[model samples]
Target chain A: SAVISQKPSRDICQRGTSLTIQCQVDSQVTMMFWYRQQPGQSLTLIATANQGSEATYESGFVIDKFPISRPNLTFSTLTVSNMSPEDSSIYLCSVGRDFTEAFFGQGTRLTVV
Target chain B: QQQVKQSPQSLIVQKGGISIINCAYENTAFDYFPWYQQFPGKGPALLIAIRPDVSEKKEGRFTISFNKSAKQFSLHIMDSQPGDSATYFCAATMGDAGNMLTFGGGTRLMVKP
Candidate 1:
């Protein structure tokens, strides 16, 4: 089992601001992913954070909007570049270890006002 | 098009009853199927999973039935309790290329006592 942690459980941010969420894993992991969950909806994959390489983003999501960085195997960061009411949602970071199961962080809840 | 599809946007079950959530996938390339459970304001946690080679897997009170031929799978929570109320997501992944996951729409289940 892998234990994951996310910083700033929640925050109320104003529009046009940016919020950077951090993901930390207890053990070294190969893959880390960022996800966004809109209100009353399922999770949407934002990007795959690969250590020492550019994050692989999903369609409709761009690096300029949600930049992700994974400098090491145990840590990653996701930045919501510009905040908006529509961007108010829960951001989650997940880790896949040995291709067994995904372990997720507690999530950072951002409420863009 | 959505790669994974889940049914019963919401469900209500009585205590000691059965809670069932179903999912289907359109991608034949996906080799791993997993179910995740999320409480309000919390990130999703892996609940159970199955591979294409397995038809059924049971862990405690939760069972995953996989139908590889139909590209369908379902989660069954036996002896449902109020503590089981939460949002459930069924996801599939290629288990390669960093093991990125494609999530289904999700199901909200409420087990009443």
Candidate 2:
């Protein structure tokens, strides 16, 4: 199990504004991922953040909309650029450990007004 | 293209009773199955997981039943309690544990006391 700390537990922002969520882990991990959970919907993979490389985003999600930065093994940031009502969702950071277990942070809840 | 499908969008179970959530996937290459429990205002936590090598795996009062041939898996919560009330999501992934995970629609379980 891993302990993750996510910043800005929640926030309500005006539409068209941007918000950046931060994630910090207790230990260095090989893989870190970003996920989005919309209201009353399932979790969707947004991108995979690997240190020293570009983030690989899933289809339907582009880097221009959601930019990710993995500066180190234990820290990562996700910025929701040009936010809109449709981007209101819970953003989570997950860390993979030992090739078997994946642990998640508390998540950042973003609400666009 | 929803690769995973979950049933009973919501569930209600009495205390000490059992709660079951089912999920079916379309991908045959998926080998890792995991169950996540998310409380309001929090990230989804890893509850239990099972690989295709085994048919069932149990951790504490939570169990995961997998059927590789059917491309399906289910989560069973025994002795359900009010504390267990939350949203449950069943996810599948190929390759490593924290790779791009495909999540189900999610089941809101209310364990009534």
Per-prediction DockQ, in order? Answer: 0.66, 0.64
Docking class of 2: medium
Best model number under TM-score: 1
Show model 2 residue runs off by greater than 4 Å.
none
lDDT of 1: 0.90
Q: What is the fnat value (0 to 1) for candidate 2?
A: 0.69
**Candidate 2 local lDDT, residue A52:** 96
Q: Where does candidate 1 clash, by residue pair?
A: none
Each model's iRMS: 1.8, 2.2
lDDT of 1 by residue, B1-113 (tens): 24799999999999999999999999898888889999997889889889999999999999999998998999999999899999999998886644578899999999999
TM-scores of the candidates are 0.96, 0.95
Looking at model 2 chain B, which ten-residue stretch has the lowest summed lDDT? B93-102
**Per-residue alpha-carbon lDDT of model 2 for A1-113, expressed as tens digits?**
78999998999999988899999999998889999988889888889899999999988999999999999999999999999999889999998876656788888989998
